[model samples]
Target: MTKDFTPPVRLDIDHLQSLYRSGGLTPRQLLDRLDDYQAAFTDRNLWIHYLTPDEREPFLQTLEGESPDSLPLYGVPFAIKDNIHLRGIPTTVANRHVRIVPDASAFVVEQLLAAGAIPVGKTNLDQFATGLNGTRSDFGPCGNAFDPDWISGGSSAGSAVAVALGMVSFALGTDTAGSGRVPAALNHIVGLKPTLGRLSVEGVVPACQTLDCVSIFARTAAQADRVLTLADRRNPTDAWQEHQQPPKRLMGQSFRFGVPAADQLGLVEYPEAQALFDATVAHLEALGGTAVDIDLTPFSEAAALLYDGPWVSERQLAINDLVNTPDQVHPVVRDVLSAGDQFTAGDAFSARYRLAALKRRTDAVLATLDTILTPTCPAPYTIADMMADPVALNARLGAFTNFMNLLDYSAVSVPAGFLDNGMPWGVTLFGPAWSDSTLNGLAGRLHHRVTDTVGATSDPLPDEQPPQPLRTLQVAVCGAHLAGYPLNHQLTDRGAVLVKRTRTAPRYRFYALAGGPPYRPGLIRTEDRGAAIEVEVWRMPEDRFGSFVAGIPHPLGIGQLELEDGTWCTGFICEPCGMDGATDISDTGGWRRYMASMATTETRQ
Candidate 1:
C-alpha cells in the first residue's frame, strides 16, 4: 500500500472517475486508504461492521477489465445503512438481539453493485429506526461529521456523516419520518428523500412499511440524481413498489414557491435559524422564484400524527418479538415502541380518517405552487442536549420533514449556510410525487449558488452541466384557447403555461369558423396566398396532452403547424370540409384582430 496515498479531495462520482481515467489512483489503492481512515475514527462509532480486505476483494476483481466509461458508478464506493441488507452481512438495526444475515442483498443494493459500486460497510443508526436523534444506537451514538459534540441527527446518522467526511461517494439510507434529511442538514451534505415507494424496500427492515422510502446521501444533488436514476427499478417481489410517473404540473423559469406563514415557521426562538431561512428565501427569489405565504396548519397537524397518533403501532409491529423482551432494545426505543400498545383499532381508524382529510388540504396548497421551501430543522442541538431531552429534541428536528412521506411529496435537502457555531444548516425544496427530477434540478442550482465546498472538504463543487428541461409539448393556439379568451381556462386548468407569442408560418390561411356562443378560429395550409397569422404557443405537460387533445371539437384538431421561427409544433388545424361556410380572415392576420373588425362592423350597423 502506498503510505502517503492521498485520496481524491472529494469522493463524488465525477472526481473519482476523472482520477481513475488519469491513472492517478486505482480502486484498490483508494479502498486501502479508506481502511486507514476508518481505523483512525473507530471511536466515532460510524460503522457497525466494516468489510475486511478479503471480503471486498470480489468487488475489486470485477473491475479488472472494466473501464469507468462503461459504467455509470464504475469503481465508486458507498456505505449502506445497517438496516438495509448486504448479502451475507449481519443486518443490525442498531440492535444486537434482532440481527440477522440475509442470503441476498436488497433490490436496490443489487442494482448499485451491478453498476460497479462497492459497499465498504454498514453504518450505525437509531435502534429500530425509531428516533430522529443519533443517540439511541446500541453501537454508540454517531456524532456530527464537523463536530463530535453536536448531534448528527437521526436514524441515517452514520450514512450522512460518511459522505460528509468524504468516506464514500454516496450512501443509502432510509427515510420514514425524517431519518434521511435531518442528518444531511446537521452534517452539511445533500439528502434526497424520494417519493414514497419510488425505490424498492425489499431485504430491508421496515419502520413504517407503507411509508418507508430508500434515500440517497451525496456531496451534491447531481450525484444524488444519478444514483436515484440507477436504483429506481421495479421489483416484482416488492409489493409496495410504485412506478415513476410523468409530471402532472410543469415549472418554468419564473415559478411560484410556498413558505410557511410567520407563526408556523418554528424558527423564532432561534434567531440564527430564522435569519438563515430568510436568506434562503431571498436566494431563491434571486433565482427567479416568487414566494407565496401558505398556511402550515394541515401539514403541521399531519406531522404530529406520525409519532403522537396510532402510527406508533406500525413501529411496534415491525419488531414485535424483540420488543417483547425490552431488555435487548435501547431504553428510548423500547419506550417509544411500547406506546403502540395503548391504541386500539378504533383509534387507528380515526387517525387514518383524519390523515385523509389533511392530505386533501395539503394537496390543494401544493396545486397552487411549484414547490415549498422550509428549514430542514428549526435548529441544531448538541449531542449532550439531545440525550438529555431525547424525545422532544428529536421531534423538533423533524418539524419540516415528517410531513413529506405522509403527504406523498418528494424532497431534496441541500446545505443553505452554516450557523455561527460552524455547524451546517439546510433548506428543503419539496413538491408532490413525480416531481423528483424537477426538485433535484432546482436543488442542484441552489446548492452551487450557496456553497463551493461540500461537507468538511476544501475541494470545490464540480461544474455541473445544465440540466435538460422538463418534457413538455408546445401547442399553437389561435382563438378561444388564447390567453384571456373565454376558453383559456381549459389550458391553464391542465397545468399549461404560455411559452411565447409568435406568428404561424406564412403558408397558412386564417379562418373565422362558423360557431356559436364562443367562436373559434382555424388555420389551413395554403400554397400561394396566405398570411403570417399571430398565435400564442402554450407548453403543456406531456401527460396532460392526451386529455387536452380529446377535448378538441370537430372542426379544429391537433395537427402539425409550422411557426415563423421555422419550427413545427402540435397546433390547431382545420379540416377542408369545415371551411365551406367560414369567412376568409387571412387579410386580418390573426383572430384577435378579426374580432375587433366584427365589433366595428356591428357598431356601424
Candidate 2:
C-alpha cells in the first residue's frame, strides 16, 4: 500500500476541487491517501489525535451521498492542532491527563466540515503552546519533515509536519508569538496568523486568552487566505471575530522594512543565518521593499515579558485545573506551568502596563513604515541540540515571535530558502492589528514572487515579476522617511515604494537631534568626518516627490545623497548649523541602525 500510494505532496485546495469535480478521486480516495500519509510518517511524530477509519468513513460516505455543489472542500483532507476541539477525536494537547470530550468541534472545525473538508486528525504542539521548539510536546517532538535530524518548529509542530509530509491539504494551528509561523519556516510551509480576534477563538484552549490567535497552515498563502475567508464568518460566541475584506493592494511607495542590525545578539553568532536573512532583506528591496534599521530593544523587552514576567500565568489561568493536578499533566508541561505560580495579580498588571508602553513605542516606530520583515527564526537547532538546552533553545526560537501577541499584531511566515547546511530559512511579515488582510495579500504576492516552491512540495511556482511603474523617482531615506519610523508615514501617505538599502558615501555625518516624540536624525555631508551611513531608499511617484520636497524643514533639506559606492539619489540631509547641539551619532551610522544598537545596550543594562 505504501508503495502504491503516491499522494501528491502539497495538494492545494484548487487541485482537490478539480479532482473531486472530475470524479478522478472521491472523498474515500482522499481518506485512503490520508491513511497512506499516516503510514509514511513512521517516526515523524506528526499527529496527536487521528480520526479512526470508522470515524472518518461516515463523513466520506456522506460526501459520496452529495453532489459537488454541496462541498467547498469536497474530498480535501486536513489536520488540526489538538488544542482545538474535534468531535469524536481526543484533543490531547500533547498531554495524557487532559479530559477529552467526545463531540465538541471547534467553531472553525464545524465550518470546515460544513464546507466539506474532512478532518483526518489532530496534530501535536508544545504543551499548552508554551515553547517555540516542537520538542516540548508530550507526543514526542515533531521532527522536521524535510530533515529528520532538525527541530520542526513549534508550538505548532505537528500541523506543519502533517502538511509538509503530504498528510493533509492544509491544517489548523495556533500562533501566540511564532507557534504558527516558526514551524512553517522550519518545515518550508506557509503559516498565517490572522489579525487578533479575526478568527473566532471560541472552543479552543487558550495559551494567552487576551492575545491567543487561531492560525492557518497551507501550501500557499492563497490557500491560507481562502481558509481564513471561509472561517471568518460571523460568530456571536466570539467577540473578537469581525467582518472584513482582504486588501487588494498596499498603498504608498517605498515600503520601509525594519531589519535587525548585524550586531544584534540574536544574529551575532549565527552568521550564516544572518547572511541568509541579509540576502532576504535585500531581496525584499530588490522586490521593491525599502529596508530600514530599528532598535530591537522594545521588541526584545516585550518578548521577555511573555515568560520572564506574568503572561505565563495567563496560560495557567486558561487550563488551571489540568495544570494544578500533578499526575494529569506532562512533566515538562508541569514545570512550565508551575513557573506561573510565582506571579501575582500585581505582576500581571505591571507587565500589562509595561507592555502597553512598549507597544506604543513599537507602534510609533511601526507607524513610520508599512511592514516589518525579520527572520522567522534567528537560527535553527536540531532535536539533539534542543534537548541539550531546552529552555535557552526555546527562548532563542521565540526571539522574533514572543512580542507579536503582546503588541496586538498579525504576522505570516513564508519560506525564503535553505541554509548552506540544508536547513530552511524563512522570513516573516508583520503588521499592526486588523492588517491581516493587507499582510495576507502582500505575503501572497511575496511568496509567489520570491519563493520558488510552495510548502514542502517540490513543484515550483512560476516567478511573478512585479510591475515597475515608469516615470517614478526612487529616493532613499536613512531616517524618518523609513516606514514604521515616526517620519515614514510622510512618504507612505504621499505614495512611495521602498526600493533598496545602499550605504551613503564616506562623506556623510549622522546626528541625533536634541529634544526631538519622534526622534529625528541629521545626515550631513563632511569631507573628513563622515562615513557611509546605512540608509534605505524609497521611490516616490515623480509626481509626489516634488510635494514631499516642499514639506522639508530647514537644516534638514532634501539633497542628492551619494551611496558608499558613488550611487546617489534624493534623501534627507542636514546643514552644518543643525549639528551644533546634535550628538555625533555618526559612529552608529544611520537612524534605524543606531536605534538597534541602543536597544541592545538597554536590554543588557
Candidate 3:
C-alpha cells in the first residue's frame, strides 16, 4: 500500500464487493494488505492463531473461479472464534491444555469458504467459551476495541474486535448466553444468534450443547443477514439442526415489540444504558412499531436457571475430559463448571421440567407481539471491574441473553451508540423460533434508526436499499374498502397495508353496485369513454388472499384492472349482466365522493 493510500477501515462485505467489482482491488492485493492492517493492532489480543500468506495460500487459491457477483462473499476476509474448527488448525477453546488438531472445518465454515470467504485466522475467546467477560482466557483477554482498559465482551470478544478493528470482514462465534451478542454491543458491530438449530453446530466446541447456536458477527445487520442466508441449513448428522421452516412474515412494516416493565429492567444504576434504551424504544415507535411493556418475570427467572440451576451441568458435560484436572481451567470458569458436577440426574431433570413450564408461559407472552427488545448487555464494564467480581459481573452480562435458547428464540444485536466514556452499547430484537428473517428485517431498520456509521469506523452506511415488496399480491380498492372507509378493517385485519392512492386508467368506468346497507362498488374497463376512477392499492399477504376473495359477493369479483400508471393489479370488477341494474357513478371520480354527495343531499332534505 502507498503511504498516501488509506486502507478501508471497515471491510464491510458490501464495501469490499463494490471495490472488487469496480476494479479497485483484488484478492491478491487484499491478502497482501491484511499484513499491514494486522501489524498496526498487534497489542489488541484479536487472534489466537493468525495464518501467514504461505499458510493462507490454499485458502486463497480455493477462490480461483469465483467472482463477487457469482459468490456473495467473494474475496471477503473472515475470522473464526478458536472454539470452531478450521482444517489443519488446532481447536483451542482459549485453553492451551485442551488444544486438538482438527482435520476438517466446521459445517458453517465450510459453507462460507465455499462461497469464497478467506479465513485469515482463529481468534481468542474466554476459555471453553465459559464466561461473558473476555478476561477468562489463558492467552489474554480480547481487549475492547475502544479502550484496552475495558472488557471486549466474550466469549466472542476477539471475533467482535476482529471485525470492528478491520482485521477481517466478519467472523463466526457461538452464542449460548449472549456470548455472540454482548461482544457486538460493546465493540460496535452486529451479531446474530439465530434460532437454536437454525444453523448446524457440528464443529463447534459445545459450551452447553443443547443451547448453543452458531452466530455471525459483522459490521451491519445486512451483512449478518447475508451470512445467515448462506449458513442456515439442516445437517442431518447434527441432532441440533432440526430443519424448522421459518414462520410467516410479520404483518407489514408496522409491528408491536415488547419491552420489560420498569421494575424488571433494573437499569437505573446505569443511567447511560437506561437513557440509550429509552431512546431506542422511542426510535422503534417512530419507525411504526407499537411498544408494549411486559412482565419479564418468567424470562428473568429462566435466565437465572442457566447458571444458578442445574443447566450448568451441561457445561460440565461439554468438557468431560477436563473435569478431573480443574487446575488447567481458568479459575472463575473452573469454579462455574465444577458446580455443574454437583447437580444430580434427578436435579437436572427437575430443572428441565421447570424450564419447560417457563417456556409455555413465555411463549404465550411472545405471541402477543412480533418481538421482544432488550439491552444486549445490562451495561458495559471495565476489564478490571469484571475481574474483581467475575461471577456476578458475568451473570449481569447474560441478564437479557441467557433465556433465548432456553425458550428457543432467534435474535440480532445491533449497535446503539457510544456513551460519554467512549464505550458502545447495543439493543437486541428476538422472537420465537423461526423468526430469524423477520427479526433481521426489523433489526436492519432499527440499526439505521440509531446510527449510520458501521463498527468503530467513521464511514456512514451506504444509501438505504428500497425494500422490495413481499411476494404478496397487490389489490386495488375503489369503494368502501379504501382507507378510513367502513370496510377497510377487513384488509387491515388480514395484514394488508395501503401502498398508494392513485387513479385507474382513463378507460375504466365506475358503478355503485346496487347492494344492501353494506354497500360496495364495481369498476369496468371500457374501450374509450370514461373517467380515471379514483382507487387505492393495497398489498395483502398471499396466504390471506384466498379468504379475502371468497368474501366477495356474486357480481363483484377480483379481476385484472389497469392503474393510472399503466400497471395491472387485482381489483373488484362487475359482471356485464350485473352492470345492467347498477347505477353509473362514473360522473363522480370515485365512490367516496359519490357517497359524500348523497350525504349532502340527505342533509339538505
> Model 3, residue 219: what's the lDDT?
71
Those runs of model 2 whose alpha carbons end farther than 4 Å from true positions after fitting are 1-6, 65-70, 240-254, 462-605
lDDT of 1 by residue, 280-328 (tens): 8998999889999999889999999998888889888887744457688
Which digits, one per residue and each the tens of the lDDT, describe model 3 over residues 216-254?
Answer: 998777777778777765677888787665254453557
- Quote model 1's TM-score: 0.82
lDDT of 2 by residue, 1-605 (tens): 01112445337777667777887877776677567657867577888777888888767776767766677777778899989998877777778767577477889888888888888888888888878888877788888887767888999899998877667888999988789999998887789898778888887888888888899998777778777777877788787666653321243434677876766636754567777777778777866678888887888888888888887778778777555566666566667767899998888888889988999999888887778888887878889998888888788888888888888787888877777776677889988766665566567667765566655556555333233333356687877777678878887776565666779999977888765646778887888867888888776556676788888776788778888777678778788888777888888877877889978999999
The global C-alpha lDDT for each of the candidates, from Candidate 1 onward, is: 0.86, 0.77, 0.83
Residue 273 in candidate 2, Cα distance off native in Å:
1.2
Off by over 4 Å in 3: 1-10, 248-253, 321-324, 466-605
Better of 1 and 2 by TM-score: 1
lDDT score, candidate 1, position 567: 91
Misplaced by over 4 Å in model 1 are 1-7, 321-324, 466-540, 545-605
Prediction-by-prediction clash tally: 0, 18, 0
